[model samples]
Target: MIIEGVKLMFVGMTTVLLFLSLMILLIQFVSFLTRDATARELEAIQKERELQSLKRKKKKEASADSDEDIAVIAAAIAAFEAERFART
Candidate 1:
């Protein structure tokens, strides 16, 4: 009788384990399906952000070049003004 009970217990445990493993696999599959679309969307957003960063960098470079040019012009004007003052 004890042997029979042990066998029955083993069978029950085996069945429970199998069912649990199956459930875990199902859950993982469903999660993958749900997140796959979101993952693609996140990738697209990341690409857009990188593109925006590049554009900002270009703009900053352009502004810096313009600022340098303006400084050169201002310095030239200042020198011209000093020369006129000395002449007067």
Candidate 2:
């Protein structure tokens, strides 16, 4: 009975480790795909979208903007509309 329990424990541990490794690999693959953009063009596109939304939001609001809002807008514009770092 003791031998059987030991065997089962080992099997369970091995299975758990295998499952954990597979999960780690899947997470890594997903992150890589999320971060990758073809020739960095997609990053530019995404930044443009961010800037457009920020503009629309600012236009619709009449309240005074804080430094945070200006900073965010600047960041979006810098990311999207920079000619020096064009994705070629």
Candidate 3:
């Protein structure tokens, strides 16, 4: 009975090892087949990120310009009110 148990354990371990090795080999093969496609996809993703960053920078610059415009308008309005009050 002890011998039978040892044999069973050996067979089970060997089977598991073989299955894991085969799975690793299959994954490597698939990756090898798709390597070029994956590289292109990575490049596309990087380009998209760069474009998004540029868009964000442009938006920030535009908002900064608008903030300056708003400040100038506010100053003009304040000057006009002060002049009117002085005349009154």
Runs off by more than 4 Å, candidate 3: none
How well is each residue in 1-88 modelled by candidate 2, as lDDT tens digits? 9999999999999999999999999999987886756548887889999999999888667345666688899999898878657975
Q: What ranges in model 1 sit over 4 Å off?
A: 1-30
My TM-score estimates for the predictions, one after another, are: 0.54, 0.43, 0.94
lDDT of 3 by residue, 25-61 (tens): 9999999999999999999999999999999999999
* lDDT against true structure, model 2: 0.85
Model 1, range 6-83, lDDT digits (tens) per residue?
999999999999999999999999988889788999999999999999999999999999999999999999999999
Superior candidate under lDDT, 2 versus 3: 3
Better of 2 and 3 by TM-score: 3
Q: On a 0 to 100 scale, what is the lDDT of residue 59 in model 1? A: 99
Q: Which residue window of length 10 is worst by lDDT in model 1? A: 31-40
How many residue pairs clash per model? Answer: 0, 0, 0
Winner by TM-score:
3
Per-residue lDDT for 35 in model 2?
A: 72
